[model samples]
Target: MNSPDIKPPGAEPAVKTHDNRRRWWTLLAVSAAQLLVVLDGTIVNIALPSAQTALGMSDASRQWAITAYALALGGLLLIGGRVSSALGHRRTFIIGLVGFAASSALGGAAVNPGMLFGARALQGVFAAALAPAGLSLLTTTFTEPRERGRAFSVFAAVGAAGSALGLVAGGLLTEYTSWRWCLYINVPIALFAVGGTALVPADRPIRGGGRLDVAGALLSAAGFGAVVYAFNEAEPLGWGSPKVLALLVGGVLLLAAFAAVEVRAPSPLLPMRVLSHRARAGALVSITLMFVAMFGFYLFMSYYTQTVLGYSPVQAGLTLIINALAALLGSTLIAGRLHGRVPPAMLILPGLIAAAAGMLILTRLTPQTTDVLPLYLVPALVLTGLGLGCVLPPTAGLATSDVHPYDIGAASAAYNASQQLGAALGTALLNTIATSAAASHLASARHATPTGASVHGYTTALTVGFGILLAAACVTAPLILKQQRS
Candidate 1:
């Protein structure tokens, strides 16, 4: 007689065959939505100068274009997650796509900076719903370990390379057409993603005992909003300014209150149990730290290629293709192939090491450096890309893996929150460091040329970023050890 634990051969084959047929379609749908959101985060960087010129906005106001999106997306993610669980993943995902498309169209038709900013913020609101719902769907849909690995490999690769791809697409559009096309382009992409959603499995919405935690949601949103505002203020007002100081303190206090509320709430917006797993917590933290370096790379590279190397926006965007290709290969081949064969840290640790080494290579830049591309920048970027590609897929998988079904949406949103906040913090902190370094060089030196000071500033800021990447590696190392011991 067959063992009680064994499934009938026919039964297993039927289930497996169905998943094989339907899984690829689901992946395509989710991936398209993800690309829409991730690409938007950096697409504007390339178009910012043109957008500012078109809208007659000052340098001081340019950051609002990015910050507004980050603030709304990051702050409201918890509510988005909870709402997705209450309504249903498939329904919320489609709604988000539609909303995002409408906002993109609005932004494309903007007559002023205020219009553009408002549109971008609305785009973030929809994305807050779309991103987590897509991730949670992937988490629940792929039950088999191997299939899950492959799904996440594609998802993470697209996510890792989306920002680089944005630079390329943004440049081509801005140089050849108009900056408005960058926003308009998302309409087609989102509409296409929405069309594909019919193939995804019909997921049941959470019901009964899943009441919204109104107080917890409010506290978290307000707290995160304040923190995001403080970081934006720090770019121009200095870190120690009273406005920045008050916001920082208030944000922290509110967040502390949020934690207290979560622990007591009957239906917590972020159920404490979702964060109880050590591996999941570690994965979330690692994702946050990695993006700190990754976003800084994107921000600095755009300026460096344009201002220092005298490359046009199109040329600068093309240069990033090398990095994107490396990342794509590493995610599919290295991380994808090793998914079930080895421990995740086995991939993540080496990836972090390679990324940190790449940053060290970048620290060699100077005003006298003429061949930045052929020699230093290309190889360094490739290394960073490979490392990130290897690291991101596995960590993302871990963040939502093995969670209770109802909590998956919240788990996915928390991961996204970590990434968005990391990007905001990295952009603000690194920009501040670069600007301060340049000013100090001018003040202290007897004969400081603008080129010398600028290059010095870029390198100094990157050096700090390098150290942060190393710190990230250190953070992951202990978690790996703990998992091994257990």
Candidate 2:
């Protein structure tokens, strides 16, 4: 029989001497790593137009720039998570940062579209490694409940604000400098983070005794990759295309297989225990829904600003500052205060409702309308930000709260995987819906005018986006509230 005092097969050993100062420094390093990962998603978005022009990319290939990163990051996230458990978070984190910075430099200097896409994929691969490792590091670093709460609050705030910050930073870099700067920016950040990591103490190293869930990893990655690819192709190809149908079917089968593998494996890639708690499951669902609305909003708003409102890259970036600022304020003040006092569900419900309302308001924007005319959107943006701030902290807190210390890496992996999948699905689905709506509107436009068709399409897309957010709210409300009541 196993010794009762012995650590689990793959668990990290506890630190001999816990130093609070060193831990905080470690948190900074981890936070910096996370910011780099999240920021890459939107930062490149702001540079898409410039990259296209510079590389002379065809319209057909433009989406690949974004899709490549999402597919790689989303596909490999579970693998990254398991790797953290099999290896150690510190080793994985440093490795990821180094790889990501190198990839960023490659993308920045690329002269062709293919090279750029390759670099983006490389970046995603490393991001998948870095993101989960960062979260896992946070989970292990703060063992005390009070300290954990404070640590998560800061982490959640950064997650909420990172995208908007990316937009502003991307805009500034792309406008004043070159689009290459967007990719190049990670170099310095990663270097600074690496330096901090050196000063921070490493977690108790894992003994190499357990095997990787290779079968599970392949199935989950491929399954998710296929689903995302199907959605992406659905826009360019009709829904009935055989390729899309086959991929969709294959993806479903693979995911089912992954579930089967998890059940029988000696050490599951995703342990069932990580998701045993009602509050944790509810939090994951809430986060997924929130991203559905948030991702769609960003995609549409970026297009509207550039194509419809005639804003330059810099102006487009500045417009998002309002949302970022509000997110920072809300997360810092409201989210932190509400934790442990009110049920997390109570905070999540109103937040989802507010976001849905904001999306509803945005649906009314027209091509001819000035940004000032839709000033109502500012408050709505704040509402969306506020809602996100409330949901993220408590949800993150709850998800990892009950996890076994040995499985903290897996828990972090699961959380980050859900987030990436949500973003991918949200972006793909919303883009498809918007594209379809645009085509339909164009076909039925007043005098077949380009501007008129574009306006009608954008409005229709926004309307559909609002409906999606409402549906997300409906799903989140019950699960979270039920858990809260129980």
- The top-ranked prediction according to TM-score is 1
Clashing pairs in 2: none
Query: Which candidate leads in lDDT?
Result: 1
Q: How do the residues 102-162 of candidate 1 rate in per-residue lDDT, one tens digit apiece?
A: 9999999999999999999999999999999998888878878788888888988898889
Residue 400 local lDDT, model 1:
86
Q: How many residue pairs clash in each candidate?
A: 0, 0
- Can you give the TM-score per candidate against the true fold? 0.94, 0.89
**Candidate 2's C-alpha lDDT?**
0.80
Error of 1 at 450 (Å): 1.2
